[model samples]
Target: MYSAKEAVSANNISEQFISQMTIRYLTSRKLVFPTKSILDEERRINSWLGIGACGSITYGRARIGKTVCMNYVAESIRNQYGSREMVIIWNVTDHPETERNFYASILMAMGYECPRYSTALILKERVLNELILRAHETPFKKAVMFIDEAWKLREKDFYWLMDLYNNLSGKDIQLSVFMYGTRELKDLKHSFKLQGKDQIVGRFMINESQFFGIQDPKELQFCMASVDKLHVCMTDYEILSDGLVDFYFPYADGKTFFDISNDFWEAFQSVRIQKRIAAEDIPMKYFIDSLVICLNMHGKLGNSPIAFPTRKELESCVALSGYGESDDEYTK
Candidate 1:
């Protein structure tokens, strides 16, 4: 039979163990690590907002973190400007390329029900009124829309978007648009230019940037450093004091993820070289996936101490990340 003090101590240990496991699970499932790409995209978008541009295009390959970057930017804008501005993210779907569908999509994105019986004119009015109401809530009377998967939109769609832009302008509300899509979006811009659709090009595609993943060893190190210092916060509490790296490898003598970044980068490059993939961009999805794999493989979970990952372990992690397999599919 345990004494009262001993029972309390055991209970405390059990609670700590449960909390650690919970954090590990949460981090594995969903963790947002800041990246340079997100910062650069934010800067570009802010510039567009500064100049009052109608819209701009941001194109990248699939899974390069464009959507995540846009998400971060939208949140940043909302936080920075607060109630002075409105930010909305609309994901363009592969629906029919018609004015009615376009307006309906916008209405849906704004969290409004789109009745199938409503005509295009009614949908247009509903969208405009919604925007105007939202914009009026803010002091600046400004609204920004981010169109994700924008390559799904055809040229005719832009004319409809332009009509909304014009109507919002007439209402004295400033609407700035930003389109995020895959490489096909750039192709669409080129096609429009070749077809001499200067109006659409000038309004939306004039300013553009290509998004990339982890580009070089330096960038990989930066990202790893971010992970090393990342503190998981829940309900205003910091769960992991030393981030995931230290949590997993508590006996590594203070080694962090940054210490193994070079090895990880080399391992990644080796895998790509062996697979004969020419692309150098390391998609964030696989990068984070690989890190999570490593954590699961070596995490001590407060039971025992573990060492940091070696180059061979990291190589296995990268290979298992499905980076090579995805690259093959992408190339084909």
Candidate 2:
């Protein structure tokens, strides 16, 4: 069992290794796109899970696929452990604004009953008691509590986390907390110091994974290739060997998927060049949306031997969809 750092450094990926890795580990009954960032985040979470009862934070602006990446990691961990029962992943995305509601959310995720009008103390007790019971009776002894939208947590809510952390300490069932939020999460941390909550801040600082959009041309290529490798449900054909760029309606000349991917990459670069946006300005959401739109367009070719978008069609879709818009503008 290699540490996360060891695994990341050891599995350093190059273009040559991606195909092999994809065929061996990523391909299954469903599509599992493995990029460098996704793999690195998985390794870090796995390492923290092994160590147990720690905290990690993944923060970036919205639409960077932070939650999506975490979902992949959670599913991968459950599958690798051979039993979903062995690892419980609770996503607290719509968690309540209050502490009691927060504890209620955790209790509900664990299937613990919390009667109406239950006090915060009672809710906390129920959660801790259930965790302890699971350690002894259930096969799953480890848990991951994901606090998405963590920036929404108020100052008093920090103590709620501290209480949960303290209660879980010295117990057989180790837990790891992952905080997912935007840049404001760090500001929340800084405000904690003013409130003299250094310990809570320290707990969350154990590991920080910075989520990002496409940062370079290489990453853009990697992401596009990952999308290109995405398997369609209908056919048993191998896109890796034969792509649909030229074969599809927009370009019936039958260019390869790699060729199509190169075209998509160039379109993004073209946006940067023509719009004068920074080289790294492309957002992950825009890429995802563009790919989805292209796929939907390709799906229009029902029962066709190949399904893909031409360079011209892809460029048109991305531009029309406003994928090249700046993050602030998109957010607004």
Candidate 3:
């Protein structure tokens, strides 16, 4: 019944005492650390659902973790509303911009297989019926679909979606389509507007939000604290009674990841400045990558113990993360 930190202290454990299995679990598992961007996006989605808005778009730069944020928000919505709503996450793939492919994608996302010989009309019917059935399970008669990689969708795809939206309304089920994609998604909306596709823009693009990376030291600290608080687990069992920070830096004189945010931020800033990259926000992918690099390089697994990472060490980790390398041209 001793807490993780207490157990570690009681046993006088050292970095070498941590098991390889625990390290593997920590490195391999998918961990969702909460962030301000995620919370804000969740709130905006909740507001849209509360008022029964038709749809909305969430766009951000590549590697900023828009997909992760949407997935988190989808789960959050399901937990909050329980059986009152049906949420589906559709990862839009590169396919022919045809109505048949569109309807087939929806069916596939909902865990149903589409017959190869099925016509677009047949697939559309199947999708509509399936959605109606799911909507009927909930008293609210609501179905929400998050379209990830939505920038791949074309104008014709939006018209097809509009048809589905209209059909669902006819059946008294409110369908909320939330699109999560890259900056191209915002440009897509503008493209639609210029073409006078007002209805399409009105339905899905009216209420939109842009996702961003860690904007400053404060935000970086928030994300670091979140990682510190996360429980390192294997399936349902906790490997340690204490959180990740405590387990990794148990002998750091009680200094937590929160206290090292400045160093982390400065390290990233130093890398950006040296690279002459103009992007101010630290992409979430690279941020997390840098963090994992830190943990693996300095934690128990690496057999190198430090109370916290030095600025130089952090800068090397950030550079190794390839934070500004891939998207420099776009950002510039």
Clashing pairs in 3: 4-242
Q: Candidate 3 residues 1-332, lDDT tens each?
A: 44554545766764344443345554442566567888899999999998999989998888877888888899988887785238888999899988899999999999888899999999999999888887777788888999999989998999999999899999899999999898789899999999999999999899999898778888898888877776543323445566776666667777777888999999988898888877788888888788778777786556565766778778888998887777542472
Per-model TM-score on C-alpha atoms:
0.86, 0.73, 0.88
lDDT of each: 0.78, 0.62, 0.81
Kindly list the per-residue Cα lDDT of model 1 for residues 153-183, writing each as its tens digit: 8878999988888999998989998999988
Model 2 per-residue lDDT tens digits across residues 242-300: 22232123444544455566678777767666666543545666676676555445533
Ranking by lDDT: 3, 1, 2
For candidate 1, the per-residue lDDT at 324 reads 71
Ranking by TM-score: 3, 1, 2
Model 1: weakest 10-residue lDDT segment is: 232-241
Q: Which has the higher TM-score value, candidate number 2 or candidate number 3?
A: 3
User: Clash totals for all models, in order?
Assistant: 0, 3, 1
- lDDT, candidate 1, residue 43? 92
Which residue pairs in candidate 2 collide? Answer: 246-254, 246-255, 247-254
